[model samples]
Structure formats: structure tokens, C-alpha cells
Target: MNAATQYAISWKGLKNGTYHFDFKVDKALFQEFESTEIEDGDLNVSVTAERTEKELSLHVAIRGTVTVACDRCLEPYQQPVAFDGDLLIRFSDEEQEYDGEVLWLAPGETEASLAQYIYESIVLALPYQRVHPDGGCDPDMLSRFRIVSEEEFEAIEQEAEARHAQPLDNESLSRLTALRQRLEEEDGESEEKN
Candidate 1:
């Protein structure tokens, strides 16, 4: 089946009532679309379409796991996804943009493809930062990246604390004061020369 036909719903022939549909979305679907972010997943999508006198209401529910490369360690891991959203399809004499949740369908349009909406719903549900939880990432890969051990971190922190704790000695203070005086004298000589 064509990409559009694969997810098309023929609502024109159906009477005004409620209908249900179940779709198994897998790697082939993503490959057909040449999707880069998500190439492998086993998800079940349940759609409920309610046809009314002038409009159609669709409720989409998606559940399952998708494999993605971790942003931190670059290792593949399965991430669970579960979300539901609603959409409204309104028939129009002429094409026009409808705001939020509502879709405008031109006159004589008989079928609507759920592919785009279904794809977006799943992608938007994914986290912006894809990563493993805590220490779930591969330790060997993580080590290749810039990360310090507990002992090294502790040593650095202690060095900072010690530097802050120490006060300047009297001899060092005197040296600084004399240096400041010499710098001022040099400034005076330069002013005179100018």
C-alpha cells in the first residue's frame, strides 16, 4: 500500500457514529518515511473516530517502546512512550487554516491520512534530551568522554577549599605594597615623559 493509503481512513462512507481502529507501527513504517530519529520501534496505536453531523472527532492513543541512541554515551537503548491526544476535523467549502486541535478539510475530500498526525504524536512525546537514567549508560563509553572519578573530583574540591582558607603572609603583603608603589612611580615617570 502507498504511504498515504496505509493510514487512510474512509470516513465518507461511514454513517454518523463511533468507530475504532488499531495499527501496529514498526520499523518498516519509519524506513518508508526515511525517518532518522526513530528507525526501530514496536508501538500499538488505537484510534477512536466519532463522526457527527458536521465534524469528526479523533482520539489517538499510542503505547510501546522505541530504540534511540543515547546523547551522552551514543549507545542504543529502548525508551518507553505512552501518550494520547485529540483532534477535530471540520469540513469547509474552501481551504483555510484552523487553529489548534482542529483540521480543515476541503469540500469533496473523502479520506484523511492518520500517518502525519500519528508520527508527530509519537515524536513530540519523546524527551528533548535522550539519555540513560543515572548510571545506566555504558561505563566504558562514558569513560572515553570527559568525566572524572570520585577521588579526582574530591582532590580538586579540597585544593580549592585550601586555597580559599589560606591568608596572605606579612612578607607577601609587604612585597605586594612595594610592588604597587613602584608601579605608581613608573606611571608618574611616564606622565612626566609625555
Candidate 2:
């Protein structure tokens, strides 16, 4: 089968039974998808798709190591990642929003590939703000960051204390308290809205 065909599976092929499939992702797969974030690595995926009369369930277990540039130093390093997730596929005549763990695929569709999902899972597993653990970083970079962070922290604390020390009347203090309450309310509202 062609690459596109290999990527998607037909729903008829997965009726009322459990099936296993595996794919090995290497440099070629990345190249095909034009993914520059991962230039070198190997990924293994074990997928179990089971159909129970009406609903289709897919469970995917992923394991792999990808080479990525260290955030502290521009040097390349390998990061290992593992993840498991389930997708539910419900046969539907019309496109519908599904809130469950499963993804819905239209009936008669052939071959489903989890390459993109696996890649995204691995990427999400990485730290949002990656910094080498304390002494584990490059000496020069760590030293510079330490000095900058300390200076910034001190400056911020001093500014906060200075603001808090300013004298105020009872009326002014009441207004300040009200303003603080309003700000806290706004913060909570924003979080809920998000």
C-alpha cells in the first residue's frame, strides 16, 4: 500500500475484534512530514484497536527517544519519552463533536496512523521551561543565569517592600484594600474564563 493508505484504516476492517499494529518512526518519517524539530530519533508505537458492536476503541502506547537541543546550552541531547492514550471512534453519519477519550472515524474509512499524535505527545512531555538542573548545566551559562536571577529577585522584593511602606490614611487604606480585593476578583474571573 501507498503511504497515505498506510496512514488510514477502514472501519470495516476493525469490526468487533481487537487488533494490534506497530510502526517504527525514524529519519524518513520525519522527512516525509517536514518535521524539523526532531532531526534524529527512533519511535515505537503499539496500538490496540478493538471494536465492540457499536463503538471502536483505540489504545496506543508509545516509547521512544528523540534528540533535541538543550535549552541551557545549544548542544544536542537525547530525551526519552513514553505515553499511553486512548481514542474512541464512533461510527456516525454526520460529523459530531466527541468529548470522550476516543476519536470518531467515519464508517468505511481505512487505515489510521498515530504518527502525529505520538509526536505531539512526546513534545508535550518535555518541560515547558527547560533548564538544566542546577549544577547539571554548562558552567558559564549557569553562572550568568544565577547572577541575573538573583539581581532581578532582589530588585523586585525591594520595590514591593517600598510600595508597602508608604504611609496612608484610613480612607486610603480602605481604598487600597478594596483595590486589592478587586484585583483578586479579576484574577479569579480570568482563570475561570480561561
Candidate 3:
């Protein structure tokens, strides 16, 4: 089934009542969205849809793991995700904007797709710091990106200037220069804040 129909619910014929639905989420979802942050996933979505005279309410719950890049080391790792939320679908004669809490639907529409909601919920559930557990990053990659103390940064700067050294590759040197500029900007900002 197309992703549009895979997770859709046909509520046009349903009487005012409660219904349950299950949908499996996989790498196909991320592929459909062309997601850069989430590479792959194995997840289950359970939805309890309640139909009323005026509106439909869906309680969605998702659980599983997704493969994403580690923010620190840029290596792929599985991150567990769990999300629970309620979505309200209100029908109107005019098409309206969908706020995060409520979904506006045209009265003529027969089905509502949960694909976008499921994708967004999983993404939102991810941590701000998408990194592996302590000591989980690849040691080699960590070694490539080092954060130095202010004094150590100055010492490295002095040695490079004094020796006219080009010991590092272009990529390494670029990374070092960027890091140095960021450190200087941070220090300047802090001094201004004081």
C-alpha cells in the first residue's frame, strides 16, 4: 500500500464509537520523508480512535528504536524512542490550518493519514543531544576532534605561528581554525555578558 493509505483510517462509514488500529513503522517511513537525521527504524504504532458526532479523537502511542547519527562522533547508533499523544480531528466546511493539538479536515474528506503525525512524533521524541552513552563514541573519531583549554589553544597557536608549521592536513587545519574561532567568540560573548 502507498504510505498515504497505509496508515489512513476510513471513518466516513463508522458510527459514533471507538475503534483500535495498529500500524508497523519501518525504514520505509524515513525513506518516504527523505529524512537525513533518521536512517532506519523498527517501531509499532497503536492508535485508539474515538468517533463522536462532532469530531474524532485519536490517542497514538509509538515505541521502538531508530538509527541516527551520534552528535558527538557522527557514527550510526540505535536510539530508543517512545511517544504518547492525542490528536483531535475536527471537520469544517472550509480547509483550515492544523495546529499541533488539533487537526482540521474538510467535511468531504473520507480518510486521514497518520503517516506525517507518526513521523513527527518519533522525531520529536528524540533527545536534544543525540549521542551514545558515556564512552560509547568511537575513540578514533573522538581523537580527531579535540576541545582544548584556552591556555592549550594559545600554546598551539603560538607554536604554529613560530614554526610556520603546516603539519596537519587541509581538513584537520580547517577544523582546528573553526574550533579556535568558536572558542574566541564564546570567550568574547562571556566577557560582554559580565
Candidate 4:
């Protein structure tokens, strides 16, 4: 089902009273909104609503984990999510924008949609530095991004100048030496046979 219809609460049939709703959040909701930060998640959205003659007050709580890319290693990791906020829905005939705290719905509308609110709340709740726990990053990826000291960079630059080309690493240098030795041995053997 579309996220718009799935997360909506119908209130036209009810008299003034309090109501509760439980919703499960999965990949579909994020996919519907084309969320780039949140790749996937398993979350619960609990909403409690108090309806009166004028407006509906909603208390929203969300808790679970979402998959996101780690800033350090660039690998996907699970990040915990928790958000608690309140929203008020008021009936109006004129068009009004949702200001994160209040929602304006026409009196003729039967359902109050919570899809955009829920998605926005999750995005805002994410941490600025999204990453996995210490020592949990991929070693290989971390090594690729290792910081080079000034001395190491200077040595590399000098070596490059001496070689008049890009400096070769230890492994590459050893392989080149072994290949040269093998070629010399083959040349010696052929000369002896001749």
C-alpha cells in the first residue's frame, strides 16, 4: 500500500475521544519517499490521539534501528532511531502549510495523513556523525583512508623524484626484483647451452 494511505488515521467516524494506533515501519516507507540516508529499517511508530471539537492532538513516538552508511568506513551499519514529538491537527478551509508542529486539515477530509510527518521526524532524529562503534569498521577500508605523516609523504616524494616515476610499494619492488633475477638466470642457462 502507498505510504500516504498506510500511515493515515481516520477520524471522521468517531466522536470526541482518545484513540491509539500502532504502525510498523519497513523499507517500503523509505522507498516511497526516496530516502537516501536511510537504506532500510525495522521500526515501530506509536501514536496516541486526543480528538476534540476543534482539533486533534497527537503524541508520536518512534523507536528502532535504521541502516545507514558509516562515515568512517563507508560501509552500511545499523543506527538506532528514537523520536518523540507532538502534532496538532486543526480544521481549516483555507490552504495552510504543515509547519512540523501543526497540521491543517479540511473539515471535509476523512483521514489525517502522517506519512510526511513520520518521514521528516526520522530524518531529523538522525545523528550528525553517523558511524558504527569503535573497532567495528572494515580494516581494509580504514587502511585505504589512513592518514600519512609528513615524514612518510616527504620520503615518498623523494623516492618518486629519484625514480622519475611513481614510487613502487614494497610488494611491487620485490616482484620486479624476482622477475629480473629469473630473466638473468634464463639468459645464463641459454648461453651455457649454446
Candidate 5:
């Protein structure tokens, strides 16, 4: 078969037994997959394939470091990932079905490639929200965030104060005070009513 097929397992040669394989995935391998999340990094993958008369089972363990952009500052940084999972490759007459951690393949199929499994393990290992620790971020980036936060806080406080200091004539003030008294009386009444 072609390179991609070769990287994937061929079901024809598989025997009804367990097999162990180790692979080192580098930048070139990621390029082959066109994976943007992991542009450059060396990943260690240990896979175990067990075949029975009825179906096949695969277990994959992956550990590596990948360079990814920081969500906060948009700067590139290294992130370590570790993953361990199992896959059940059952024979099906219909099309493949992949649910969460399980896979269904054609019963007639012989070999299954580990490439897709490795890629998925790496993807799953990534954090949902990636950010550097509080003080671990870049100085300039942290300062910028701090300044923006302070400015926003000041603006909000000013808006609240301005709202509180609205100009009111004596008549309006008296009406407002009367309204306030009415509200207080209503609250007191409710408290007693309750």
C-alpha cells in the first residue's frame, strides 16, 4: 500500500494474539497529518493490539511535549501531555462508528493503523483552556492586562457615581424621599405580613 496505509495497520497480517509496538512521532509525522495544534514535538507512543477470533482490541499510551500558543498572550510555549486509553475494534457489517473511546470497524478488515489513534490521544491530552500561571506570563503581557483591568474598573466606578449624583430640584427630592419612605414601609409591611 501507500505510505499512509503502511503507517496504518493492515488487518490481513494480524494473528489472533497480542502485539506490542512503539513509535516515535516527530514533526514530519504531524505534518503528514496536517495537525496544526502540534506543529513541532516528539511524542512517544506505546500501543498494544490484541486480536481474538471475533474482534480486535487496541490500547494506546502517549506522552510528549508540544509547543502551543498561550491563550492569554498569544505567545508560543511548551506544554506536556500524557494520555492512556483503550479502543475496542469490533467487526461490523455497516460503516465505522466511533463513540467516545470505542471504535467499530468492518469485520472483514484485517489491519488497523495506529496513526489516527495516536493523533486522537494527543488531541485529547490538550487542555480545554490553555493559559500560563499568574506570574508565569510575560511581563509586558501581564502589565497590559492589569492596565486594562484598572481602566475598566475606574470607568465602572465613575459611571456608578455619576448615576448616584443626578441633579434633582427640591420638589423632585421630596418626591424621591417620599417614594423611598413608601418603599421602606412596603418592605416593613411585607416583613410583618410574612
Candidate 6:
């Protein structure tokens, strides 16, 4: 069976009520979609499907950890992921997408696969900047970037801050103030004309 087939839900003969399905999502499932951001993960996905007369609503809850490359160290590390989402499937004569949060099913459709939705929820739950906590990163990689003493580092930071905080000369400040006044006057004149 294909990857999507495993996640398909058949509503052909079922009555309108609530249903539950659980799946263990791993690297294989992600790779099926050619996902490159995440290489592997161990997550439990719980899907709750509630069918009513007008629509079918699905609640997706994903919780577990996934391995991602560190932005600074470039080493793979496990990152915890927790996400919750809702999908609304509406019946229509022809398949049509109302928006990102809603999907349309044809009148004769029998199955709906949730593999793509599950993948997107997991990926979106990850942090944009993937990095280990302080002192958790590889020491060897950090040493290559900065090996200075604590006092030396503090001194360098203070020096940089002082440079940024220095005030401009009086001549330059006066020139800037005059330029600002001129711009404001020009703006007022243009507004009056309009």
C-alpha cells in the first residue's frame, strides 16, 4: 500500500459520530514526502474524526521528539514537538478548496488521507532557529569559534558598546536638525495644496 493509503479514513458506510485513529510517525513517513528539514523522529499522532450531517471535522494532536540539524554546530539533535490542529472537510459536487483550513470532498468520495496534514503540523511545530541550549552544544565546535578568556570577552563587548554609544559632533547634529525641519515644512506645504 502507498504511504497515503495508511492514513486514509473511509466514511462510506459509517454513521455520523466520533472516531479515533492513532499512528506512529517516523522518518519513513517524512521521507515519503521528500522532507529534508527533518531526518528522523519519534512522534505519536492522535486523530479524532467527528462526522456530522454537513461536515467532517478532524482534530490532530502530535507530540514527541524529532532529530534536526543544529544551526550552529551542524550536529543532529532531538527536538521536542507539540502541536494541535483542526481540519474541516466539506462535501461538494466537485472537489474544491475553500481555504488553508478547509478541504472539499466530492459527493462520491469515500476516503480522505491525512498524511500531508500530519507532516505539515509536525514541521511547523519545530523552532525556526534549531540550536542546542547553552552549554549543551558541542564544546569542540564552540572552541573553534571563540577561545578567549572571560575577562577578555567582557572587555571586547564593553568596547563595542562604548563605540556605538558615542555621540556625534555638534556640527553634524545641527545639520540633521535643520534637514528635519526643512522636510516637515515641505510636507506641510504639500498637504495644504492637496
Residue-pair clashes per candidate: 0, 12, 0, 0, 6, 0
The order of the candidates by lDDT, greatest first, is 3, 4, 6, 1, 5, 2
TM-score for candidate 5, residues paired by index: 0.63
- The 0-to-1 C-alpha lDDT of every candidate, in the order given, reads 0.77, 0.62, 0.85, 0.84, 0.68, 0.78
What CA RMSD would candidate 2 show? Answer: 9.2
lDDT of 6 by residue, 106-133 (tens): 8788987777888888988998778776
Poorest stretch of ten by lDDT in candidate 6: 145-154
Better of 1 and 5 by TM-score: 1
Inter-residue clash pairs, candidate 5: 8-113, 9-112, 9-113, 10-111, 11-110, 11-111
Q: Write the per-residue lDDT of candidate 3 for residues 1-194, one digit (tens) a residue.
A: 77779989888998999999999999999999999999999999999999999999999999999999987678999999999999998899987887778888899999988888999899999987777876678878866865334566777667666657556557756866986887887567556644
Task: Give the per-residue lDDT of model 1 (tens digit) for 34-141.
Answer: 879885988999999999988889999999988888876889888888979998888899878755477778768898877777777778888867778767889898
Error of 1 at 113 (Å): 0.3
Write down the RMSD of all candidates, one decimal each: 13.2, 9.2, 8.6, 14.9, 12.8, 11.1
Which regions in candidate 6 have their CA more than 4 angstroms from the true location?
A: 145-194
- What residue runs in model 3 are displaced by over 4 Å at the alpha carbon? 147-194
* Model 4 vs. true fold: TM: 0.75
Model 1 alpha-carbon drift over 4 Å, by segment: 98-100, 148-194
Top TM-score model = 4
Native-referenced Cα lDDT, model 5: 0.68
lDDT, candidate 1, equals 0.77
lDDT of 5 at 194: 38
Please write out the lDDT profile of model 2 over residues 34-107, one tens digit for every residue. Answer: 76666677778787888788876888787887776666554566667687888777777777755545555666
**Residue-wise C-alpha lDDT for candidate 5, range 85-161, written one tens digit per residue:** 98877778989557756666776666666666777678788886565655456768756753233344455446545
The TM-scores of all predictions, comma-separated, are 0.71, 0.59, 0.74, 0.75, 0.63, 0.72
Per-residue error at 190 for model 2, in Å? 23
